[model samples]
Target: MPASDSDAPARAPWWTKAVVYQVYPRSFADSDGDGVGDLGGIRSKLDYLADLGVDAVWLSPVYPSPQHDNGYDISDYQEIEPVFGSLAEFDLLLAEAHERGIKIVMDLVVNHTSDEHAWFQESRSSLTNPKRDWYWWRKPQADGSAPNGWGSAFSGPAWTLDDTTGEYYLHLFAKQQPDLNWENPEVRQAVYSMMNWWLDRGVDGFRMDVINFIAKRVELVDGPAAATGGGSPMGPQIHDFLQEMHREVFEGRRGEHLTVGEMPGVSTDDALLFTDPARHEVDMIFQFEHVGLDQGEHKFDVLPRNLPALKQSLSRWQDGLAATGWNSLYLNNHDQPRLVSRFGNDTTYRYESATLWALVLHLHRGTPYIYQGEEIGMTNVRFDFIHDYRDLESLNHYREAVEDFDLDPGTVLAGVQTMGRDNARTPMQWDASPQAGFTTGTPWLAVNPNSADINVAADLSTERSIFRFYQSLIELRHESEVVALGDFALLEPDHEALYAFTRTLGDETLLVVANASDAPLSGPLPADVSGAELVLANYPADPDAAAHPTETTLRPWEARLYRL
Candidate 1:
């Protein structure tokens, strides 16, 4: 470990104050001319992460796959995909990262596997095959309809009929990715074995993908007429399966490993059960209550931002898990759009709003994750053509909406431009070069047109860079106990333009105030903040207000942190 690991006094779990950076490998960096990011590219960026002060790197899947879901549909669990390099390179990346005092957390996607996987192939090869029971295989009704009214998350029916076998297999996602039958003990053991194999290779933890969806309704109940698709992700046996997985994969290695489940429909009540230490399910959960606020009935149906509801949702999680469970605070990842563009103002007050958002999230009581390109204030992409998108979800939606349902192309394009996954997957901007210094060869996806202004090189050269603000936030979390483990109180929870909160630990208290809108905001102080010292201020202190720097009044997109 690096000398800075022990800089702070002892704490129980190492991750509470630690920040984890998420790397969507394919868009992070490209070492070879293949125009795709690989393990070697990640190895070259270790120093940059070390300087940024993140304690861990949560990598999206790099396993052998057909790239149908961009590496989510794994065909082989034990080896790396050829485009992303080999197992030897993966091992080297792990060794090099640990040398810089950074832990590696691999994405664990056990809920499903590619149709080309050996198990799936054998399962579908014959109805009476030994591995036939490894997947959900159901017979059609008398009229030759699907098992039920269930629909696939990608578009149509969840059951894709195998022409040769004459039986339908359940695929909650793209037909190429089939959901595994966890009811089979063999399947559970296989997943456990694969996880242990990775652990032995020195991985620090896992970011489980849709982990709650592994256990589904065994009865296969019929769905509503509308067919809301993908069935209930939080099944009846979710807790039982999670406990069994913990015992098999991380029982004795407890505090040494971190497990964060990405559960979409999880409630605060259910999150408590998943993250409570006594339950042995996981270390934390990535809940979607806050992120889903801006989306309409459909994920791509973008809507205007709602600040009050966002405050209520996040505050509930902070207070709900206050005593027993933990939280994972993140605004962007491989599957979500850029944070600044989605929630914060990205055009006029780009730098100010970006830093303000960081201040509000990092001060909360959770383990924060910084997605790739986020430190440099990256924005969503605006592609002129629909064919330029590479995300499976976006492409599928556009096709179904236009060709089949006869929807207007302009409306559909507008939705995806505001709320698309590809907006977050563009190649990382390294410099102001024509290619943004991401690759010498053409990129797998088009670079953002505004990359020249938002690249890492320009941000680092500026005095008031978002990168420097993020670096300070990480340092504060590592050094201040109040910011990490203190009791949280959301003040002015219903305020329209002002977001206020406080963290108290023993005799020390930390206050955070932010103006989330573009206009100036004035409000009464939540506490006496009169004598508090201004620890952080994004805007220069006005000469007249210098004598009283802790005032609750703020400029457009201004955020201030005070300590008393």
Candidate 2:
């Protein structure tokens, strides 16, 4: 029995004990031999997700789109893309997910809409249109420059001039995705109505994409914040909008629905405001501070790994939100490269590193999100040429670097190979088949060549399987209060090779020690864990060592858990 089991309340939010699995639909599984993965493919994998022991499945956008931003540029919010299926198929998928005791979370991308969306089309149709105010529109400067100096996240200026309207519009991302005008009350209500529609249809909640960028400061209307450019317009009105959204869409249904905002430039203090229960904004947020530790000037400008920097960033969030707010823990996602290849070893120490990283992540105080291919140790891809990449960010940046400037092609390609988003978009490795069992037809993206060895069938056949390890971790979270409600504290804070932490709730203390490097090392045990009980370890536990539990030696990429 868990030591703090009695202290935990029976009616705590379902999300507090939940484990969310993110399924990038385009690459998760392909059905009907269409090359593109669809709702049916996800439906076919419901059993696999349930068997994996996830509490909720978060599906990336599948709305009707032009496929410019891979469904993020939604043409119709209420309908599924033809390639993915229809609204009826979505309803069936939702019903099936609920039948297996798993909740479904839809990605909400209200920050922008596809330029082809009816709303944007009407807004851009003519200046006299009723929906003209639905989007941010501005005239060019006297010098015929863009409305402001803001740059696009996908590369280039944030403002795009419409040929017919002779006016510029704001787009924080790709030009095809235009920013919505949240200053308009009608726009807010429209978004709220759409959200309520999804919740009413049995969808559990939303994982909002760039939700924080919805409310821009008034300064972004005509000019830059300073000479350096407006810089991803975030302002005070964001909380007001979120609170109003909660009151409108999720007011009556508390504790049943989950809302996790994916805020890119949010700070710890600001995250507390957004997630505080009293604020009534959101349940948790996905902050980018920890993920940006390895990034140099920009995300693609990757730097060598720094264990201490990563530890500090994660610990800051853990401690900052310990009292009021909540955190969403994730190492990689649809927009990120595979964690095993980026942070840990994907070659010689693959299994050890993968399970060790999983153990470290799950033991953290926040709710852990497992990306689809993480459990089996799927890794980053190595596409030799730039044309093999599909993400707009990679392609656009490569073009700007090579054609616009005279940078070496090989140097730029190295960044794409190391940290490009395409690495995570590879087809899921279900088996050792030619297609990696993801599809009967050619996959939309190439299957990572190493899938034959690092796949579900191969891993499950091994004596120590990563899938089984993740299953145990999920079960542990469901059963232990110390894991769900514990206060976190970092140990060996400055250590370069070892990562250690402790979680404490009431009189219960759980310690985790991980050797992140590929070298045998010894460190002193924390004083409180002198006679700790060895609860779990990636490697075999020695009976003699387990008796006293004072030794602090670890193998390459080793991890251990103890109860003190």
Could you say which candidate leads in lDDT? 2
Q: For candidate 1, lDDT tens digit of each residue in 50-140?
A: 9999999999999999999999999999999998999999999999999999999999998899999999999999989999989988776
TM-scores for the candidates: 0.96, 0.97
Worst 10 residues of 1 by lDDT: 1-10
List residue ranges in candidate 2 displaced over 4 A. 1-8, 223-228, 528-530, 542-548
Superposed Cα deviation of residue 351, candidate 1 (Å): 0.7
Give the Å shift of residue 51 in candidate 2: 1.3
RMSD of each: 3.4, 2.1
Instruction: Provide the clashing-pair count of each candidate structure.
Output: 0, 0
Off by over 4 Å in 1: 1-11, 221-231, 547-552
